[model samples]
Target chain A: MAEPAYLVASDSETTGEEKSSSPFPDIAIGIDIGTSQCSVAVWSGSQVELVRNTRNQKLMRSYVTFKDEIPAGGVSNQLAHEYEMLSGAAIFNMKRLIGRVDTDPVVHASKSLPFLVQTLNIGVRPFIAALVKNMWRSTTPEEVLAIFLVELRAMAEVQLKRPVRNVVLTIPVSFSRFQITRIERACAMAGLQVLRLMPEPTAVALLYAQQQQQSVHENMGSGSEKIALIFNMGAGFCDVAVTATAGGVSQIKALAGTALGGEDILLNMMRHLLPDMDTHFSTRGIDEIRRMGLLRVATQDAIHKLSSQSSVQIDVDLGNGRKISKALGREEFEDVNWEIFEKCESLIKQCLHDAKVEVEDISDVILVGGCSNIPKLRNIITGVCKREIYNGINPLEAAVRGAALEGAVASGVNDPFGSLDLLTIQATPLSIGVRADGNSFVPIIHQNTTMPVRRDVIFTTVHDNQAEALIIVYEGDEKAMEKNHLLGYFKITGIPPALKGVPEINVCMDIDASNVLRVFAGVVMPGVQNPAGPVMEVRMPTVDDGHGWCAEALNRTYGSTLDLVTVQKKGAH
Target chain B: MYSNGVGHLPRSDPLRFSFLHSTRLENPPQFVSFRIRPGPAIRSSLNDTISERPAMSFYELLGIPETGSLVEIKQAYKQLARKYHPDVSPPGRAEEYTQAFIRVQEAYETLSDPRRRALYDRDMAKGVHLAFTARRRGIFDEQMEEKSEWKSRWQSQLSELKRKSMQKDSDDNMSWGARMRRERNQSS
Candidate 1:
């Protein structure tokens, strides 16, 4: 039989140049894979359109079930009810577990889920398994995610009637460069090429820009700039961004995010409703899994009800004569999740301070994501911005729609009505630096700096006749190097024999529009334009999985012998 | 990567996508003449222009008067940003547009903050640009003559140090240079 063009998975390494070089331009689709839900959208000629699955549902549950001979994902499978997903055979919430090691507190918190999550706490990947046929079948987060993505790709192909290869996926802003690589790896395994990975709020910002541009044309105005504060809280992450939009270009001024989200609220509520929930679910037997599922469904229902109502009553009976009943009031729920709400407020303030934007100057306040409808979250956002929420966008669909617009714009598509004339100038969400000056993070490119940027800093040897220096790159906002995410490390050698602090080491970091990071280093003596040796240019985030222990190993071996100190004062750029 | 001539620009295009290309000149003849002039003189002249130069004032880059209001500065920045951002620019000239876009952002970054802008203005009045205070670039720029001048200066300085050390050695036969060499050898 001849191979079906739509069914064959293409090579994963095809780049944008190659895609554009082809005769027929391939318009990449936009996908938002949320922690609890997933949606796909594409630019169909003049406007963005969301694609539906076989059941004609736009938003599908994000999970994969391994109950049968062949595993089935939520994309096409017909799930009877919510309880079915909470069963031990289904593995969900991969967004929280993906790219996180066992030592991460987030992974430790996930141990209470119905599925089996085992951690050794040795700075390695956590062990995740699904109960299949009375046996614990081991699997990885990447594998589960890829399986789900494949189903989505098949459904899109069937609907669009073309070979779907490229995609633009929206991710959480707090995800590290290492986490991004894992997402890319999963996409590759699913036989999909990632064109662009946009942070969720930036994607929403792009959509808002398009809307503002249209409004400006309708009014025939001068296209004055409009600043919008975007707060997105989903099941997995919370992100805040400040954007200034004018003439269809949304320039991100600042961004802040954290891993705290709605999932924490659910867990908190569960613990409150059942005080001994941990001890009860500690033993992962089939009966215990079923009982956990029952309580989880009840608590989730109560929380959803608390969004619209003032109070809710949760009543569930676990087998073995365990019965619990309680009333959860809105005020009580707020008290339970007060820490998460406080963090959200602080993130918004930090973003505003970094962007140099005042709350009164904010023209629009956009609330998006799954948890945006919660009354407490809504009040917190409005209180922080001191403005009513903008109702122009749908909270859940905004991210996917913006992603679709980016996909169309980046694919070199054109529209006669000028709707496709849009752009998003992104900023680095975290500071990128090198470990220097006694384990201090000397940032070369500070957070909130615009893209396609190049900044260099000069450093010198800390010891006399030090021939080599280690350039360990990290990405974070922390002052200490250990608190940041280690991207990569290399050594610069062949320095001329000189006194301490005499040999100049020039380290330059460049981030392109597509967000590719490159670090360049060379040794230059005084008054010499020619470096002592050839320059070394390496792409960043070179460390792979299990990199959590790499920094410790380096410290143990090198012992600060190959240290460097900053030669210039502040604001060297 | 440091070829330092026109020949390297096109060859380096694939590796450093936006770096050299954004700074690529439109007129070939003007670029050649610009490169032929002495480095320090041209650099000093460019620095005085307050635009596209290392010491260029933020006001000039945004095309606003030094006394321009914050609103006026923001308006100018937004206008230029629209004109030069790579995504909105014509596809063929995207690289060239990116360079202007970055300069606009840099100007805005400083001028958008009142405290930073005030300090920058003070420094501008003193004729001491912040760009000159730090040792940033290496030999990666495409200026051949500048590199050669730097090399000659370094060679002359090294020779002067050697000459002074030799003279001292001839006078005392136990110069500090000899002592330092002995210490270095022992340490090694």
Candidate 2:
């Protein structure tokens, strides 16, 4: 069956085995699983076309409803009305909560959902469930996402008349290596082998590169460099990227992203509607779940209506003589969600700064995502970029289209018209480093460095005669080690007890074409032709679930005995 | 884009020349070593390129003159990138194309940055040639043990890089005016 084939493909691909030797390589479909909506697109011989489901829906709702013994997903499930999704049986917005620990503020804020999200406030996965048969059925975000992806795969297969195994999924830029592993695991569960995970904004940049290449062809120009700034804000995350395109190659200069999106806006509006909503809905009774569902549906409707209207009248009723009737103006909605908008502005600014691009040099500003329709966000992005939004691509379908283009390219599909002659040189979205110099993060590969890149940093032991040194790798721009995400940790033994700052411990980080990260470390002393010991190459994100407390545990057990500091280089100066 | 195949060997042609030359000097027997095997066609093609050019400057690798501007550099980079990028290249020559593409990218990276370009210019003026960091291939492809052996041959190359960086640090120690004067003198 296709399920077993998927497991074998994923396992081999994860082991970095080359699968391109087959004469007819399978074309990986591109899937954009948005927080609230999802779409599938494939390169169909001549052009990218969205794969519609049996219901002829191009964009399906992203949710999985637990009913009876089997679960139904949005891809094939028929919902009677919008309120049915909010009835506590549906699990949606798994993208935001997939890899987050229970102590995260995002998880804490998710408690107000109609479904049950119980957090112990410890550094562990949150407990989530869906209402079934008047009882709570335990579930996880990964399980719900896998069920949804399985439905998507089945639908695409039925329409395309082929087994869909490989997929290029679009993920947010803010996702850590651990989150990416979770995404890969979900795809594995769905019997899908992930070929690539393109960041949302970078995918848009690829689409823009194609558009620019086409224009250059029409004009018979030299295909000069065109600098474009992409701002993408979806239902669950916001991302920005600066790219330079020429000759069908989009070189990503920098990327910035944050986990702030439309859900936060809806929650804030819900709070405004009923001040005591959290306390009133704290109890997980059936009546409160129904009331919460009503409020969620009402607020979602108002938010959507406010996109085109000046004011939206929101009225909802709860049991026990509780009611909310309020007028939500566009200005009021914008004011309430000012933090989200502010974050969007800062992400664009930070991306521009990191790219070393000036506003005057930006040829086009591309805004593509679900939230691109928000007037306030549009203004903020345009104001910062000082350019009007590029209108050549669809806001919702841009990412999936780009992913389809990437799928074809990575699959080695050749085209006569040169439409497939495209490449996106990606950049590292976050710094991957190790803890050194007394708990400070020392980045071996800094953020915004180009991909297929390898960089190394030399370090020395902090304690004299220290035989072993711990290499606790983290990913972020944080200066303090605790603030960053701990990817994994390893120990370099047999360092040949030398002075505190004598031996050179080389820590190298490499991100290859497929976005696989491997960390190599060895002890290299001056005047030594060979390393002290055999080098160790470890694939990253080696830590498993509930890894949030590993860093604290490492510090507690070893203290400062195995710490390393950056090696100081001396010269004639 | 890149309909012509002229730039396929535009960059790696000259660098591969120096690489084979250094290999011949450092460890000539390694090419025939049983552990390291290249196909006869690859060996012959590599030998042919050895006589093409002995060494290459970053500017020469990109097919641009030393005085090329940032725009010209970017154009050359884009052209070569389109020709040799792994995804765009024909499937039969992905391995060869990827190596050339990395050289072009590295050349563009060093030349596009003003500070790095100046340092490279200084090194070139002082007759300190830049050796290809062969470790990149070894570190990436585990199946290719030849790369690791090739990396050991370039250990002295790393020391050269270290010395160049030390010179750069001493040059950086000067104040803005002094450094500008030194740069002007070097250029002159």
Candidate 3:
């Protein structure tokens, strides 16, 4: 729906009156279901049209307040006053909480919020609830997200004046296949088909690719392709991607992301301003919730002002004779959130190194997302890139806009419009492998490998007369599977009785273009199609609930007697 | 060849000549020749300095200046590596590109590591053959006396590292339970 930018895109710009009829006559919408904010946009015949709610707010607060029998999402229903939002009924930040176990630090962090977040830390889902009329009403993170999506869909349908079903959602690069499944289920619950789930920074890269294609028309310049470093950090996650673009081909060289963002910084600053503040603002009755809301609002506004000015003052009274008055400086703000800034710098460095590019190789540094506007964050990025940033794209809407462009491209819209030819060759952001080498994590497909990729690693039995070998699959960069995210696991039985290091158990991981991961395992003799054992192929991330615990239990029950070591890394050294 | 002027050619480079016994050297000196000039009886890669030089530093392979920043190093490697990446290049030249790509990758691996890069830089800075020079200074020489002590310490560490690596390579095949049992027995 960004007319000015799309105007610079597509061949239709040149053939004006020829295709004025409408660029995208039919298309699915792109939605960025962010942790704190959400937005939806679509290719509207000629250009993208950002759908707005009845309140005319393009960016809807991602929250579902449970008050009446029927809950209300912020997108569908707006509360008249800020105080009403603090009624201890709204469940916000569901994106961070979804698909997480109680032991997760983020779940622990959520315990400080206004609503109830009770945890046993026993690998089960945390208990989340909202206080309504002095009674605690239980809810799951998935339920909260489904309600929000339903509201967002209704708004988009109303604006499009048609039944909106298909959508392309922008997700964090660090999101595991397990997390993707949760997002798909949420979409399914909302009565929508997921045409594609694009990583946030990859979506930005697509937009950059289109821009590069359009710019080719104006400048007969350099003629060389350009490499862009896209750093996107919203309220919930921070993601980085390096892409090479030429003639509409956006080949993603590297991608890196961390589950840390504005919310963590805001929480850090709040704790700094009010020491032992958790004791005062922890989940309680509706009155304490109101106090928590007031303080949060004050802290958020102060942080926003800090971005513009050097300092800001905060004076707010949480009822019950609690008064807080403080003057916060910008340096103090950065000092409080040093880890966030440090991570931002390291992520950029890691992405650059992974892409095998030096700062000089980067033709443009694109900073997007809500956090990109912060002065300190911007300076940190400049320090790493050793150059100024390209801020032509609006920070707030870039991810959604990129997603919208992807929707048009994915819809098979061939064009008199130049944008349709845009293609992005993505890469795996993390390694996918299994536990082998006496519990050492052996990766079959490493991070930064071009997709859709297929690679196999051979493993052998650790003990003599072994029959079955356990293939516990995981995805992450860690050297130990204990530290990585357990995707799924299976036991490959019927290995012909053999001495240690004799059986050839092959484990191959294939990641298709759609980012679907399938792991295949079989015991094979060299050059033989039919092996001594059955070949098992299974889709990953199906290992349900507390996989961290499951990995340990498997090892405890079944010793490493049948464990396998890598055959040999197959690339020429 | 070991250049007295600036950087030495990598010993592994096919273009460089290695140390040979003075008795075996038919020609005295040429564009490149062993300068350590060992007595007819002695033969050692360490005590004798090679006209062979050391392996190429990661920086030299990447074609970036030694003083180049980390970013510059990465950029140089990336651009060159991409030119040789098999996926993008024509398949008919796959063999040629594959070899070149490996070299580019090897260069990047060393240069990108701060610890490894610093180690290489230190070694590069010590371009002179102290061991060769000290040997000629004789046992009674003060400089030789001090160097011998330093040389012994380095030799011991080198042997220790060799032992550790040999153990590690074989340990890769050992199961976790077996390793624990072995450790327990060793402790007992």
Candidate 4:
């Protein structure tokens, strides 16, 4: 009898010996686990080596399809065909689900993407459920990501012939502390130690700066100044960052990113072209187009052609003798995806505004990521920003290369990562204070001050014989604390009862280096010796684990047989 | 709101006016006066309290040149504050350090504000000339009371010391300092 598909193989040979003498692994991996496509790159001792999937492909379509039910013995044998046959069931663009609520605008926007998503109701907790196959079900974004990470890890392990452990994952600049923690936890569950969770634009800027350094050395003797604006247009997001360097200090002056990017533009173009097809046939007739996979292939082809050619004929292979073809020009593509182009332009302008600089101030503009290959996007950014864009390096691979350089720098190896001189960009609310009686927060710390600073406010008791006071902490510039998000609250107790106006209490709010806030209070009595005071400590909230979901997932996947082998080895010893 | 509440206070009791309400007083506390000893004279006001004092000019408090730029003034204040911040220093001395630091900070802030600094510069010109004449005559009004207080206090202390010395001479073999020096030499 065949073992269960979910069962861990008992006699599976563990490859690669643990070498204690080796200081560190020669290879470092950078995994860009994106929504539409997942790409993995491994940096060997020297250059980055792209690891292909089991099917020998550099990138995998982030789609998992499931069958209605298995036919008899099992569905594993028929899963591949079913994946293709029931393409409607295939859930793509999982990145949109990561760290988002069901009511989030991005979740609604994901409807435009070509995929099937199910909303699961688990008690009061509403989560996204993606059916990967008859036997596999992903109920959360982390689980879906774990499946992709596992595949990427296996690919790296096979290619390098060594155990790959350290990885650098890229996240959006706007990711909250909780979101970053969740991604970190998911990576940890997949047996990968995340060295750092770097912002995508920062990684791209580092990569571009590294390339510029190499060119400056090779062509110009030295001392040549170079500044670049990295416009990263990925499948699910677009972000722009301005990087400037003089001497050895590099700074990311500003960054702007949004949830709209290349995939949105393509979908918009698809909607435009598909409706035009309805002129020749009924809307329901497109069902045949979907079944034949012509719609998927045609849409992708048109996007590819638009990158290089002014116009290309999208031919729909009807599988029968009949065929349909339509010519899509650059003008038509721009008209169809004008909204996306406008968003990209607005983000670029926002970045420039935040930096308080002009386009002329930037020496070079580097276009990066797979979506950046779109000619229309490239032209729009260049024309609007009024700077010449550089496409000398592959945008798809730039972030990974930069991540590898970062890994090399972390491992104490000599590399170009240092020459890049990337600056860390952080965005947090400017002012923090507490609420008063009339729903007003007495402003304690003003915004725009470089952090790791503290400010104190002194308040007297309002009522006579009062012993305790509440310090309600809030984030935002709102005058009222109730209007802002209550970060945390602490009560200062054990104060000696005295006349209302006589007792004094000093509340100190300190924002630490990590942008986490801490509150400390001091209470004093009129004539008491060594009056009792209370100190309340509140840490930032981390991602919540709903009763060991990751641990159980790991056990179901890699537990039983491995444990037996370990037991047997111990017995033999 | 205020007119109706005037009669509420008892006539015999002193009606207290907070910093926010009253601008003038029958007699305000002298800010420049300090209790002097043989060592450095310590200011009576706490650091946070000096902000309420209106008599002292900003330039005199910060000890900075009139022509100092904003950056220079800020740097000087930060340096002085780090040196004198109560948290890092000896416990009891913090009150004095905090007072001086706050006065210095207030001076920097006043001078940094364009309008305030302009008014201050004019007032400073007249004040400096008066102070110079007062100093030359050896009749500095600010120091007169302080000097007299120090003199009278020291004289009384001196008499008490003489009486103690006379009593000690009959009983002890050496002076206190001499005996301490001898003990140190023996220990070494």
Clashing pairs in 2: none
For lDDT, the strongest prediction is: 1
Tell me the tens digit of each residue's lDDT in model 4 across A40-103.
7755555566677556777666654443542111111223442263244455566665665443
Tens-digit lDDT track for model 3 on B90-161? 312323344455456545545676864665566568872232232222211322333344345535654564
Off by over 4 Å in 1: A1-25, A568-573, B1-69, B88-97, B114-188
Deviation from native of the Cα of residue A502 in model 1, angstroms: 2.0
Tens-place lDDT per residue, model 2, A1-573, is 324333233223222333444333456789999998999998887889999988899999999999668999999999998778878898889998998888778888888888889988657899999999788999999999999999999998888877777788999999999999999889888977776799998888998999898888889987789999998888889999999999788999999998888888889988988889899889878788888888888888899888899998888887689988888899999888888888788888889999999999999999988888888988898889888999999999999999998887766566678887898888899989888765456677778887656566678887788889999999987533566788999999998867778888888776644466778788876666566887777888898878877877786677667888776544211
Residue ranges of candidate 3 with Cα displaced over 4 Å: A1-26, A526-529, A568-573, B1-188
Those runs of model 2 whose alpha carbons end farther than 4 Å from true positions after fitting are: A1-25, A571-573, B1-54, B88-100, B131-188
Indicate the residue-level lDDT of A367 in model 4: 88
Full-model lDDT for every candidate? 0.78, 0.76, 0.70, 0.51
Candidate 2 TM-score to native:
0.82
lDDT of 1 by residue, A1-573 (tens): 133221112111132233333332467789999999999999998899999999999999999999998999999899888778878999999999998888888999899988989999766889999999878899989999999999999998888877677788999988888888889889989978676889999999999999999988889987888999999999989999999988788989999998888889999988988889999899889899999999989988898999999998888999899998888899999999998899999999999998989999999999999899899889989998999999999999999999999888766677778897887888888988888765556777878888867667678998999999999999987533555788999999999999989998878787654466778888888777667887777888899878877777776667567889877433322
Candidate with top TM-score is 2
Relative to the true structure, candidate 1 reaches a TM of: 0.82
Candidate 2 per-residue lDDT, tens place, B48-163, comes to 22123236777878999989999999999888887766545432234455557766787888889897677677767877654243222222222123223423433444445445
Ranking by TM-score: 2, 1, 3, 4
